[model samples]
Target chain A: MTAVQWILENLPQILELTVDHLLLTVPAVLAAFLLALPLGRLAVRLPRLREPLVGGIGLLYAIPSLPLFIVLPLILGTSIREPLNAVAALTLFGLALMVRSAADAFGSVEEDVRLAAVAVGHSAAGRFLTVELPLAGPALLAGLRVVSVSTISLVSVSAVLGITSLGSLFTDGFERGIVASIVAGIVMTAVLALVLDLLLVALGRVLMPWRRPAPRRAGSREPAQVGERGAA
Target chain B: MTSLLEALDWVLTADSWTGPGGLGVRAGEHLLYSLLAVGLSALVALPAGLFIGHTGRGRGIAVVSTGVTRALPTLGVITLVALAAGIGLTAPMVAFIVLAVPSILAGAYSGVEAVDPQIVDAARAQGMSPRQVLLGVEVPLGLRLILGGVRLATLQVVATATLAAYVGAGGLGRPLFLGLRNHDYAMMLGASIVVILLAVVLDALFALGQRLLARRPGTA
Candidate 1:
């Protein structure tokens, strides 16, 4: 059957798998982001912690996803078939990547701005929330975009472990020689990643209303440039 | 703890170490695939990236392609190719090369772009051709970041090459998928341990190489 016809007939299964894919991805990315924020800040704030923190993260990130998934069940005391194992492994992968970006994001905030907030009698917490976080918003968002895309793609790998994500399509399709289902999975995954990326961009706009598209002129810096630089 | 010990026992078994499907043979296959992919990818991506970075053109292509490729699921790529190619080395190799190209491309361009503009101007002022400037000046200075990209790509290929087993191509993944099929967790864990060790050892070697390159007089 043609790939199009195959997809049309399997739409329900496809939808179910997409939901499974998102269930694994969204939580993992969110948890990684939330946890990475503090860890990244500590890395930046404590010079002593910077090397080991980032270095260790880089080391862990180098582990293959399949192996990490296989070994995680043992480490987390979860059953081999548990989806939680997939989520935890993905969180580690995402967190490993995002921590460096998070550090660079917070580090990108100017010292002058922090001092200025302090000079105006803002408490340490207040300055971080009002001055530092907002100023670091663009870079953090850029980092988050990478994490989200990566997590979304990596979710499919869990299907091989029988955890059931869109990746299941690939494994099942290969077994049955169904090219269409595999194609559908690939398209759906890319679409999910694109939609999430756009949503994050929109969210960034709403959260930082001051950051409009920079006017292109001889000297004006482009906002898109910031996003590029922030990515690894 | 018991499973971990079982996995260790599996690894230590002489039978698991010597056969056609043994860890040594599988690991050699994995290494061979990874090296070919990373090497071929660098050959294609490095010059293109250097050109873009040096000329300050096609930066958009680099950025967009990198984002798109990064979003492509590794499993999907390998499975699809393996299906079409009839389950051989071709699919995994193609997928690995595809996976590695963007990284090496991004690394080469970014490394060159990160070079100080004043230095490029100094080389140009000395009447050096663009080729001479790129090779003699930018490449040497940017060697650390450039090699950093290769290191990352190599590691990625090594890790992903395990998927070759899914397509009936041999690698350490042979035991992994075999264990999965037979419900052998110890075998799965054992193979995974070897894969992880390979990655770590290669990573350490790359780290050492990067440090040595950095120590060269011109690189810093």
Candidate 2:
């Protein structure tokens, strides 16, 4: 059968797996974000802690996914088939990526802004929330965009262990010799990643409206620079 | 602790080092797949990326391609390709080559792009041809970043090559997937430890080379 026909028949199953994939991916991305915020900030705050923390996380990324999925059950005392194992591993992967971005994001914040916030009597917490975090917002979002895409993709590997996700399509399709199912899986996974990324971009726009670029004026370079910075 | 011990025991056994499906064979297979994939991908991606970086053209394509490839699930790609191509090295090799291209491409182009334009201009003003400028100036200066790309691609390819076992292709993943099927946690852990060590050693070696290159006078 053609790919479209196969997708039409398996729509419900595909949707269910999509939900499962999202359930695994969304939380991992958010948790990594929350965890990395402190860790990234710490790395930025203490120059001495930067190397070890970032380096350790980089090493964590080097661990192959399948083994991590298999061995996590042992580390966490979870059952072999536990979805938590997958979630935890994905979280580690996401954090490995996000922490570096987080550090860079926080580092990208200008010192003068921090001083300005302090001179206006803002406390450390206030200054960070109001000044630094907002300034770092775009870069952090860019990093999150990457983390989200990768986590979504990585979630599929957990299917080999019988965890349901779009990746199950690949395994089942391969075993059954149904190319359509595999095609469906690839398309759906890519769609999900792109959609989530667009959502993030929208979220950034809504939250950081001032970041919107000014309309182009012929022969003017300043607005173009602002646009480039915003895009970055 | 017992499981960890069992894994270590499995790894340390002389029998695990010899014969078919042994660590030696599996690791050799794994490295072979990784090497072929990365080498082939670099051959394709390096020249293209370097051209793009030198001319500052086709960046949109590079950006979109890298983004799309980064989002591809390697497991899905390998399994799908394997099924389509029938059981053999071809499937995993194709998947791995596809998986590896973006990183090396990004590395080559970005490395070249990161070179100061002023330096390129100076080289040009000395009456050097664009070809000469690219070969001598851009390639040397960008060598570290270009290697960084290859390093990342190698690590990624090596990791993903483990999936070749799913398609009946031989690699370190044989022990991994086989252990999973048979409830052999020790074998699983042992194979994982090996894979992790392989990645680490390669990453460190790449990092050292990058450092040494960066330290060279005028490169930085």
Q: Report clash pairs, candidate 2.
A: none
Over B96-141, each residue of candidate 1 has an lDDT whose tens digit, in order, gives 9889999999999999989877687788889988889889998999
Off by over 4 Å in 2: A220-232
Write one digit per residue (lDDT tens) for candidate 2, span A1-232.
Answer: 6788889999999999999999999989999999999999999899899989988896889888887887787789876577788889999999999999999999988888778899999999988888989999999999999899999999998888789899999999988999888888999999999899999999999999988978997767654233321111
Best by lDDT: 1
TM-score for all predictions?
0.95, 0.95
Cα-lDDT of candidate 1 = 0.90
Model 1 agreement with the true structure over A49-117: per-residue lDDT tens digits: 988987789678989999999999888999878988889999999999999998999988888887899
TM-score of 1: 0.95
lDDT of 2 by residue, B1-220 (tens): 7898999999999999899779999999999999999999999999999998888778899999898888888878888888778987889999898889999999999998888766777888898888898898989998888998899899999888888989999999999999989998899899988988888898888889889888898775
DockQ of each: 0.58, 0.55
